[model samples]
Target: MSAATATPARTAPGATTLPVADPAATRRYAWQVLRAHRGGVAAAAVVLLAGAFAGLVPVWLVGRMVDAVASDAAPSRLWWSAAALVVALVGATALAAVARLLVARTFEHALADLRERTVHAALHAPAAHVDGAGTGDLVARVSGDVDVLRTTVSRVLPAVCGAGATILLTVGGLAGLDWRFAVAVLAAVPLQVWGVRTFGRRAGPVFRAERAAAAERTSRVLEAVAAADTIRALGTAETHVHGVEEVSHRAIDRTVAGMRVSLVLTHRLHAAELVALGAVLVAGYGLVGAGAVTVGAATTAALLVHRLFDPVGILLSQVDDLQRAQAALARVVGVLSVPAPAGADAGGAGAEGAGSPAGHATTVPDDRAAATVDVRGVSFAYDPDRPVLHDVDLRVEAGEVVALVGASGAGKSTLARLVTGTVTPTAGTVLVEGEPAGGPRASAAVAAVTQEVHVFAGTLADDLRLARPDADDARLRAALALVGADWVDDLPEGLRTAVGAGGLPLAPDRAQQVALARLALTDARVVVLDEATAEAGSDAARTLDAAARRVLAGRTALVVVHRLDQAARADRIVLLDAGRVVAAGTHDELLAGCEPYARLWSAWHRGRTS
Candidate 1:
């Protein structure tokens, strides 16, 4: 088929996404993330500034009225001044309300964008990287880390911006009233700076450590839940519990330490405020005695200096929250900065779309006559020091079924992953139909069904439709029947029956049958089954094996052998010992000449006989 006729390649829901780059300097990235909403941010700032200056009007008017009273001014002037005070108060309050709502609305918009970007990044990350990194790092970031940033945006950000604007306007007003009082109050600036700088430096590291501790704690919890059955089976429940307790202890210590640092900074900020207020008031008294300023001027200057306390304290108090937000933001930006895989776009564009760079798209031609998988000099490692698959060369020709037979940890599954473009090799290349297997177009031509199967919370038809959303009820039923999932017909609602969490429960074997049914719906010419029948009951394994034979009839198949019987049915059996392909032959040929294969076959036969 021509490229124009073939389906456009898509990142399948379960397909691996590009790996994120290791974090670099991120302040610029943070700005870029925020820059998308600069219009709203600027609007909020303008409203807040107007409200702040309006708030100063009442203070200025009171001084005017007091001075007029002292001078025995006209009754009309006094009444006018009093009336002006009321007007200022009303204006200030109305503007402040509008400003508060604007700021909140802006934050709501920015936060929605942030949350969506974060989710897409997670969904798009390579499956192997996500597995190796464990749930802890991501779980903490998605939950606690996001919440911390939310606090900064909704609360700390507004406090910082509003308080900063108010402080500047108050100081400027005081200078206009009397420069002596303004200068005295400004003397407290150095103290505030010292308090903030010292707190910031100390608090950043502390809060970062706290976030790390939280991740560690979360990891333990997730692992315990994931392995609860295994732990009980192995009589290691107590050990797991103890590990969780230790993690919890560390998390508690970090929280207490972070709180202590914040408390010390808060106390110091209040002390600085008291000193600044006293100095301004004492200076105002002297200025009045010197006849350089009127009593009204002294009063106004004192009130302005007092007004400075609330906003200044607010600015200082939010520093700790701001520092914590910075740490969380670094992790988020790291997710966004992941480069597209070589020769593939990240997605198309926008929130849900990711693609390779411009003009770099390449599609695997839809030529079923030559759908082959090639792995050349491929090497892989979960950790660099411990390689899983060594320098291996593998090929599966069009219309061939190859069985990879190995004991556990022999890199059979890893090799299959490479062939299916589920993961990139640490070294060397995987090509499918002459294109890089990891490339977007080539990857779409392959399908893998592994032991792990998820039944999304929906109808049975909904689960079937995940493979080909346009598949009709008749097509879905045909696919299920092909895969030996007969129980679908017996369900209370047939294909319309609800399944997954909170719905009708499916056994492990039934779930694997559902997975196979979905696999039967795909158009992939190169198919991989990685221990796909391992979770099935013995009877279901037989059913699945029969169904797999039908699926593999004319396609290029790489079968990671979970059942001993599957190897006998393959066109070629590739035996792997450690990370190398030790032997390749038909099942009968391997048993006749290969000692390693003979021994493995003998053991399996013996187990089956027993």
Candidate 2:
């Protein structure tokens, strides 16, 4: 409940962390965005400075009117000062509004460019890096941190710019009225400097910790939500709920600590302002009494010092916001720091730097109609110490469907990912039609569907069109029909029906059908389906299997299957155990000849019958 009661947050050991750009890099990236809009920034600055000066005119006029009354000056002079003061007030308001508009437009353009670059970088980033960092961290960076940065840019940026201009111009006016009035304000400088330095020192680590905690909290919440069904099935909902609460509390604690530091800074700043105001008033009295300056000048000096309170408060409070923004910015820029995997951009055959290491041909060999997958002595490990796959080898000829049958963690999915170019082999090579699995050509040749399918928030046609942007409504319908998604006919709007979040909620089976339909629309010559039907019910499994058969027709395919029936239909079945291919043959051959395969099939049969 209280900031003092909250403890500092600490990261759990082995927690996933996405990259974070250093402070200098963050500043440089920000400068680059600003530099691109320098014309607008310059225009805003000039208008803001002129507005700040215009604001001072009213204070000057009030001081002149005071002198005029004291001296019994002509009434016409009073009228003129009053009229000039009103015009000055009007000009300041108009100029300030224009400056704000300019600032918003400039920063908004920069923010849009940054947002685009961040998304582009995230899309092109290495799959392994993204996976290792976890979806929450990436989502928080791209969505959460980006939003925070956007607010800071749109709101805080303009406010800070205006406040800074007003502060500087007001200080100049104070000196112009009487130099000692400016000197008196310096009495508070030491405290202000100390307060800022202390706040920065204390707030930086806490805010960074707060951000990390927030990311972890987001990751936990996302993980729990994603696995909600599994968690309920396992009767572990309470455990997951507790995990979310624990992380949420950690985030709250860090936030509270940050607030505590900010409060301390605010108090110190207020104290400094009081000291400065007292000194200014004392200087004003001394000057007026000594005949060094008139009462009007003294009043003007006090009024100018008082005017600083609002802008100065804005400047100091924004210091807290600035720290938070910088932290978000560092995370955002960090996304851009992830380098694309080597050869990711190597276009069709013999493109620059497309050649892979010896014994591996990652480049496109030649453009061909039929696609074959070649995995030669390929080994891979998510962790080097714990290899998921060993020196295994396999090949699928064009139009052949090879089912990879294995128990859990047998590297079937890993192999499928390798073939699909989602990952690379640590040793040996994976090639699609003699092109490296991850190279541009091979990537275009391969399309995959896994158990987890996402239906983007859009019309059915828009979702299908992602696979082939040029696909017309006829093609989309054909693809959907080919996948046996008759449910489309039941939809209120057919191909125009909205799906995904905020639209028609699709069942897992229907979503997978959409994914398969998208696959049907692609011209991919190779397909990898990793437990693509694992989530379907028995009835739905048969439907999905039928749809998959139609989609995989005449394609080099690797299907990772848990159900023995799916493997039974494959042209050849590859039974993987541990990290090696223990058996490879037709279903009958494996059942008759391989003890492991026979036992697996017998167990699978028993389970199905039971």
By lDDT, who's the top model here?
2
lDDT of 2 at 469: 62
Please give the CA lDDT of all the candidate structures: 0.76, 0.83
Off by over 4 Å in 1: 1-24, 64-94, 126-128, 338-340, 343-370, 457-463, 486-505, 550-553
lDDT of 1: 0.76
Structure candidate 2, residue pairs in collision: none
Candidate 2's residue-wise lDDT over 1-610, tens digit each? 0001112122333334668887877878877777888999999999999989999999999999999999999999999999999999999999999998899989988888889988877766766667767889989989999898888988998889999999999998999888999999888889889999999998888988898889989999999998989999999999999999999999999999999999998998899899999999999999999999999999899899889988998998789999999989888888887775544554221110111211124322234355888999999876566788888999898899999998899989889878867677889998887878877777767778888888988998887777666678887888888988988989999989998888899998888898888877666677788888884347898888999999888777889998888999999999898999988999999989999989998998888778
- TM-score per candidate: 0.86, 0.91
Query: Model 1, range 1-610, lDDT digits (tens) per residue?
Result: 0001111112333322222222244556556546877888789889889989999998988888888989999999989988988998998888877877777778778777877876766665554656565667777777778888888877788778889989989989988987788789877878788888888888877987787778778888999998899999999999999999998999899989989988988888888888888998899788888999998888888888888889988888888888788777766655555433543333311110011212223322324443888889989886666788888888888988999999898999889877766568899988888878767666666777777767878999887776666678998889888878888878999999999998999997788778777766666677788887764337778887887777656678888985667888899999987898889999999989999999998998887788
Compared to the true structure, candidate 2 yields what TM-score? Answer: 0.91
